[model samples]
Target: MSDTAAAEAPSPSVRSLLIMAVPAILVGVGSALVLWLLDLMSEGLQHILWTTLPQSFGATEATPWWIFTVLTVTGAAVGLVIWSVPGHAGPDSATTELVEAPLRPGVLPGLLLATVIGLAGGVSLGPENPIIAVNSALAVALLARFVKAIPLPLAMMLASSATIGALFGTPIAAALLFTGAVAAAKGGGALWDKLFLPVAAAGAGAVTMHLLGGKALSFQVTPIDQTDGWMLLWGLLVAAASALIGILLAWALPYVHRGFHALRNPLLISLAGGVVLGLLGMWGGPMTLFKGLDETTELLRHPGDYSAGQLALFAGVKVLALLVAAAAGFRGGRIFPAVFIGVALGVLAHVLFPGIPLSLAIACGCLGIVLAATRDGWIAIFLGAALVGDPVVLPMLCIIVLPVWLMVTKAPELVVHAQPESAAAKA
Candidate 1:
């Protein structure tokens, strides 16, 4: 039906609400399950794909460049397919969009296709984006196909809540992320009142992931001495620095994605950027290619593996890589990559200030930058704690978020979200 036709026949708020929600819960569970299957198959897929590819291709962990080449080619091919599909080409995801747009069906397919291409194809991205959209889309589909008597408001509630739940694996975080967006979108009153449904949906999503036997998301931080009052102080400093970097990145996104209109064709621009990135990867090794989340895991597991100089270089390189990725027309995110950059900066800061805990410094930079970039404190709080594997950082992150939030919340623009998708596609 046409949008006008649909609008004239709008489902009653109460009735539509119910229609949208049932599927949300179902979608959440389904999304978590799909994500689990993908994760489980990832290593095996990587191994098989790597074994078959030629060596003189690109960079990867342990595997040769040829593996990355195969992956890259496949991703582009997938992108071509998504470009040809009807409806929204899925979403650009993780948890953010769950809160951004609730009923975008087209976005879901586009995102799912993109993420599968990103992961299975070898271009660096994550399941979170596709997970959020697919799960939500599934919820809407279920409601429409089965539950015919609900209000759109309730359905919208269910759709959003289920997505939030599926993405965060915590109803509380899912609800918070969802409600926070609502609150931000419309400034005021009883935000908590709107949170319960989404939280419940989050629970469904989390339970589903568990049933699928996926590892719960958690971070690892070496035990830190609480006596280190100076750590928090240094955290404040790191937070400030990270805030600046995040803002700079956010600001740079529009221009970088556009390549100042110097580069017009997205695929060509992306491929060109990819080639440059590939060259850089050739020198920087596997750590230089792909999204840097795996590198963050490596850093936590073996902080000693990096010296101050190496960390500094890594930090600079990641920032550059993210800029290039944005400019290249690839569909991925900026946060987890920021995680690597933040840690690199934090490690360097720790080396400069021995009294400050390296872990604490990382917490500040990562969390602070995310806050500045997204202008959402609670989400950043959850992400940072999860990344660092430290709960203590939560309270501290909350505290640090205050000043940084004040500095950047005025406009409350998302670096990537601020730009149009075509800009992103081209960037």
Candidate 2:
């Protein structure tokens, strides 16, 4: 322990980095498995509801009455579970953000059940929040038990990176999402030092997701070979309009949530919410139900299959569906549904302005809505480019997002918050 020897020895940062590398990879693999299981559970249930039941009754997938009945029952079931179950099925989503403190280990089961049922029963929600919560909670508990040297915050960050990576089928997207936060940390060292473990975890998660044959968010987008100045202008207009629409929905979310909560009973409130969602599903047809991932693919595969008016209706109904699903007692995330609405809007815009490139139009549409809803510009742009699977769209989307971000920078996010336990219980 000579002074010279000590000075040359590995620093705490280096030591922490070494300790976390392998463990972070393991966490990523574990998180990806959890996501895969959730996808299977929900998709299986969807098959039953959309295919099996319809076949049994000699009707098409998700008949209007069937959609109504399933959603109503789903709301009741979720409400009952949240009302009487232990841990209250984790926290109310309205009270939480895309990232939050991990829940107690005991709470994960109820949360899992609620989320699976919501996804399965065609609720307009995504698995992002619940899956991340579950993984973060588990990672924290494990780290505390076996690797106390790893900080809880670090463990949580790795878990989030893993889940996000698996969700989008890439570590780059996860890295982009966390870039701002990582850079904001109070440290003078290289930024890569902080991002190393998160990126490792994200890479592992992405590889595992690919191994499991998980689908990435992609559409058959036409590649953009040339950038037009007028196209950029059109993008700004489309993006701005979409952002404004998202802001309106954001403003309405709290009031709508309050109206549902005023029922005072989780059962009645959830049931009423379910009925409303059911009617919306019926009116909007099957496209409006479930998280928008699969439906978005279906919508984009054959753009000519739908008309401008139909796309607009679909977009409007989906926005309402997303709000209701989040404000109601459902345990899920809004990002996927929001993406769907954005895509629908983009499709509608393209239909109106035939001169506009479909890829640019859709990317701008997503940029506007996602920027407004999530208020995360990096994620907004990532989503827009990811959907198109085009590198050229990146710069175009980046430019389009500038105006959209300005429009939404001062606006409120689409989340609801109220008095603690009472709101949590009712919501």
Q: Which candidate is the best by lDDT?
A: 2
Q: Across residues 24-80, which tens digit of lDDT does each residue of candidate 1 receive?
A: 566566656766665656545555555444433443354546544554565454445
- Per-model TM against the reference: 0.78, 0.95
Ten contiguous residues with the weakest lDDT in model 1: 90-99
How many backbone clashes are present in model 1? 36
**TM-score of candidate 1 to 2 decimals:** 0.78
Those runs of model 2 whose alpha carbons end farther than 4 Å from true positions after fitting are 1-18, 423-427
Q: After superposition, how far is residue 360 of candidate 1 from its true place, in Å?
A: 1.4
**lDDT score, residue 85, model 2?**
81
- Which residue runs of candidate 1 sit more than 4 Å off their true CA positions? 1-24, 37-45, 51-75, 82-98, 102-110, 121-124, 149-164, 182-193, 260-263, 389-391, 410-427
Q: On residues 2-65, what C-alpha lDDT tens digit does candidate 2 reach at each position? A: 6456445543477767767989999999999999999998889878877888788877755888
Error of 1 at 309 (Å): 2.4
